[model samples]
Target: MPQLPEDMVLPEGFVPSQAPQPPAEPRDSATVALVRDTDGGPEVFLLRRVLGMAFAGGMTVFPGGGVDKRDADTSVAWAGPTPAWWARAFGCSAELARALVCAAVRETFEEAGVLLAGPDADSVVADATPYADARQELVERKLSLAEFLTEAGLVLRADLLRPLGNWVTPPEEPRRYDTRFFLAALPTGQRADGSTTEADHAAWQRPQDAIADWAARRSGLMPPTWVTLSQLAEHRSVRELLAAERQITKITPRVVRRNGNLHVALPGDADYPEAS
Candidate 1:
């Protein structure tokens, strides 16, 4: 089990899945994380949630959020592994896992405009221009990820998502995420331009530098953001990092804290915890 955090308070009205529900629609959320190798080392993309928003408002976060209902639809083409594989990894039904991956890809595009799915330039799905417009519509709820893939003849590229961590909010928190943060190198031909809707500002910083900025109070980062950055700081290179990832057979979300400060433990580590 991941260790726990001490005090984690996001903006109000953003309740955790643990919050009281009327015996319906329990436990629904997921997250996608993109960690890249930069001059500052492994820098993870961080987005600052819009202040006064529904959830985690003003908190700096990885590009992810609650899974959409459209995530479970399976009519779309899959670029890689089947939903069944992701299902086991998430401890959920295959349908749910498929949906989570779809949300991850979709949210990554919606929030950051970074397209992680699709074929390499030389592959058949050569043009990404069409998907750009489709992505805009998907964000507008005019289409689902599955429908977009089906219509565009694209694939979900499930293999592109690497199992990172599974985090459930503390039972006491009002809003929680059974979030599975997946890791991926920035895909070719895609840019990490963050949208202003969810984030006030976005940046790809050296994980260490970001942490330093947080510690120095230069950049506003919440505990979760700090913890994730600390973990990313350990990887010196993308190749050396992804090479280590192949050895990752299991990921258990543990919250680590020292002197009341909280953090999340990486898959191959037991260093920090995220929740109480």
Candidate 2:
């Protein structure tokens, strides 16, 4: 059985329970792990949520958020794999698949200042700086992704994204999310910046280096982020990593009490405990 890292600490006020009085329903969300090729390996973009935030505060994570209702609007132009294809890949409805892809692209731009879209089907935006105003509006929710794309005369390049995994937040948490993880390579002529209010810091780091930081207590990483980085560390280049085939599966880690302390157990652990 895999053991929770010795450095792992339960959230403040967290108490192991068989079940909450009522478990919060997981909200549909999406996250994108943006990577760029480097001499050492692929370096992934990460954002450290501001400490004052409610969820995953002070933890490094990818750029993403809950799906917006407007994300499902079919009026938004798209190029690449159809929604039906994404639905099959993620084991979700076509409508939700469309929303997830849109959310992924939208959130990446809103949070990282990196747009995974293009003026047309054949190319990606070389620079995102020109859309600063729209990006902020998108962050403020004043403009929906569909509206922004439509007004900008751009298409959501669904082909630029690849499904990484699906993870459901455990039932013990007050806030939960059914999150689909997506992998996207940093476009050639664009740069990622940490301008989002949610994050206090942003940087690009090799997966292994980030893991080391977590191990040395220099940074905080939630389980999902750690696991994703570990998986990413196995590949040497962005192209190789993106080309690797993945089998999408839902993984829900469980929290349990052991010797008066809380611990997390992955699905295949020797004696995985259920919170509900």
Candidate 3:
């Protein structure tokens, strides 16, 4: 986590340009932690965001983004839990729930070159390279998931996703995202590549090793990513991890001023539990 700028020095003759505005409304978003099993353990696919991006710039994060309006298209071929069941799991309307799931699948494919779709619900694509043209179109928003799947005669494998948690950006941040985190095992025979424009690099790393790198200051990670990775580092196998159920809770940290110092406090901070 980056240090809070509570002790920055001000210029001698600095003048404020404008009054600070209230935090923006949190936009609905979805993130997918793509994991794969290795002889050593489970490793997750991670992307290092480019420095020029607006949010989480230069930070290592899971593949995800804001929900697209087209993501809610009910006409898209879907196989697995119904929108109503997803609504119950995610604590949102059926429409928004549909969009969130679609965003998760779409963003994962866009960022990691892994598509959780296939000819039917029970199957997954053996190779995703054939969809390279559609992937580009999806990235450019020239084609929606519905359009691509419809044309390709594929169905969205909604069962591949497992609900993890929900987090809202702190109220003080200029950009806020009401993000829902999801976990999915990487599809068989499909490889993830680091070709997205948003990321400078992407790699598969064991959760524990990623945490060690962050601790050693070899990479940057936001609080959510760090905390999630810590939680994931405990699992011994991807199968066991995916089989487990998650208790999703909304965590929005509060900015607390204590003894002339500033801190972002989580709900259970009294014990100051070590994340890893």
Q: Judged by TM-score, which candidate is best?
A: 2
**lDDT tens digits, residue span 1-276, model 1:** 222233342333333334354322335665666777666567678888888985667767888867888788868677766788877766778888888888888888788777655643223333355567887897789988887777766666776677666655543444445567677777766667786477888988777777667656565665445555666667797666555542223233344444544444444454534432
Give the alpha-carbon lDDT of every model. 0.65, 0.90, 0.85
Candidate 3 differs from the real structure by a C-alpha RMSD in angstroms, to one decimal, of: 5.2
Alpha carbon deviation, residue 251, candidate 3 (Å)? 1.0
Candidate ranking under lDDT, highest first, comes to: 2, 3, 1
Report the number of backbone clashes for model 3.
0
Assess candidate 3 and give its lDDT. 0.85
Model 2: per-residue Cα lDDT over 149-202, one tens digit each = 999999899999999999898888878999999999999999999899999999
Model 3 ranges off by over 4 Å: 1-21, 257-262, 270-276
Give, for candidate 2, the lowest lDDT window spanning 10 residues: 1-10
Q: Clashing residue pairs, candidate 2?
A: none
Q: Is candidate 1 or candidate 3 better by TM-score?
A: 3
Q: What is the alpha-carbon lDDT of model 2 when measured against the actual structure? A: 0.90
Give the poorly placed runs of model 1, Cα more than 4 Å off. 1-26, 119-130, 245-276
Q: Mind giving the per-residue lDDT tens digits that candidate 3 earns over 62-104? A: 9999999999999999999988888999889999999999999
As a whole number from 0 to 100, the lDDT of residue 58 in candidate 2 is: 95
Q: What is candidate 1's TM-score against the reference?
A: 0.77
Instruction: For each candidate, give its TM-score against the true structure.
Output: 0.77, 0.95, 0.89
Count of clashes in candidate 1? 22
